[model samples]
Target: MVARTTDTPVGRVKPCRLIGLEQHHDERGSLSIVESEWTTGFPIRRIYYLHNTRTGTARGAHAHRALEQLFVAAHGSFTVKVDDGHRQRAYRLDDPGTGLYVGPMVWRDITDFSDDSVCLVLASEHYDETDYYRDYAAFLEDVRRQP
Candidate 1:
């Protein structure tokens, strides 16, 4: 779980933290599974993956208004830096059995991709352009307006 560093709250959204998925290892190899009940308690509506990212490149410089997402490093590793307009934290994802759960209204910037990195993302909502806050200032404004 992510340790709270600020007394100032960010509405009902929980802070981003590392979630360990169910893993089984055998002579055949290993397998990881993420059940609905074992995740952020939201039904996954979209799933995607990022691969072949150029060197020194980054992605996800935005925040969702209502979308919750889980990110797992299916191969290699990368860094996910999240900001809640109050506190900021960086988590390194290097294990396939572990994931990072990002709640709504939190800004995310994913970077530091390895050569063979593959980032798998499971989202709670389908594609919606309007649901995203691509501007940091706008995201912070909306977060401040929350009651």
Candidate 2:
């Protein structure tokens, strides 16, 4: 199916997919950690989180040039969508122990956030404003130029 970037539920997108982390259980609750280059595939050099997002709002409507990110929902839930020019996918992040790995060249947008949601992001590179493609049309052009 041809994937069109739309706010409506009429597109077919491919999910970057979620990676389930190993959870250690105990009476005190649970613990989990991600190893860089092993489970994460990239060494995390930066960390950030998003919270207090109002309902019906969205975030991350762009793509990175070379940055890779792993997104985890530490609390509540949100829907993440990604487009690769040829295809698109949406992933629902709700489990804290699970992570969504987003690679470069993929246009992404995060929407449908719950009030109590806490989204944690582990990035492979340091912050670089020049690495971001903030325009959707530009992102598509970049993707199309890729082999």
Candidate 3:
């Protein structure tokens, strides 16, 4: 999600938001479509999925400096916690037709995976270790310095 940077007195737009995909259902099954040109604000450069995650285990304890991603629950359920230096929020993902969009500079922590869970990820960029902010304190400090 691309957040609005302007101050609103009430609250600033969050850097992470939920996006719903169009789903078609019938006796045959269900189908959901995601088009990069119309859905994701950024072009899709990579696609991946996480599965067989041990119960009680967690993932994603870092923030990206330039990458943007969308996460979907392709099988079961999990929790995604996001922080933007000043604010924090948690989202539960169980529906395959919905995805959580995480923008740059936002910290993400994924946890509480169910036994059959499969997490799908769509990224705007290729794998780059230099783009990752693995330390939370450093991520916070850097984001706070931004205008």
Candidate 4:
């Protein structure tokens, strides 16, 4: 299991398990599987991958309103910053088997990518333009209004 780190109380971040995918190694090569149905709790509905063509380019300057995400550095390495509108933490993802489960209400930024890095994101919901909060100020206000 991946380690959990939160600046504020642990109650705030609500990180779920970072499950290791099943890997098969053979003379030909290695293969890994990530099954949505096998997921313990979160039901994945969407899957996408982020490949940074530029070496230092960063992505994900916003947070999701209701979607939960699990990010994995399938190849190479990168850093993921997660903030709950109060405290923030950065996690380095270098292992293909490891992933970071980012719950809803957290602002996430993925950056510091090594060359050839590929980020695979598994989301609990399908793409909905209304579910995204692109502005930081608006995100903070929305979090404050939440009971």
Candidate 1, superposed: residue stretches over 4 Å from native: 1-12
Error of 1 at 112 (Å): 0.2
Model 3 lDDT vs. the true structure? 0.83
Q: Which candidate, 1 or 2, has the higher TM-score?
A: 1
What TM-score fits each model?
Answer: 0.90, 0.87, 0.90, 0.83
Structure candidate 3, residue pairs in collision: none
lDDT of 3 by residue, 1-147 (tens): 222333321112336778998899999999987788477788999999999999889999998988989899999999988888877777889899998888888888899899999999999999999999999999888988887
Residue 5, candidate 1: C-alpha displacement in angstroms: 8.9
- Model 2 residue 29 CA deviation (Å) reads 0.7
TM-score of 3: 0.90
The lDDT values for all models are: 0.86, 0.81, 0.83, 0.77
* Of candidates 4 and 1, the better by TM-score: 1
Q: For residues 43-139, write the lDDT of model 2, one tens digit per residue.
A: 9899999999999989999988888888898889988888777777788888878998888878889998999999899999999999999999998
Model 4 worst lDDT run, 10 consecutive residues: 2-11
Q: What is model 4's C-alpha RMSD? A: 2.8
Q: Write the per-residue lDDT of candidate 4 for residues 69-140, one digit (tens) a residue.
A: 888889988888777777777788888877777887888888888889999999999999899999999999
Error of 2 at 31 (Å): 1.1
lDDT of 4 at 125: 92
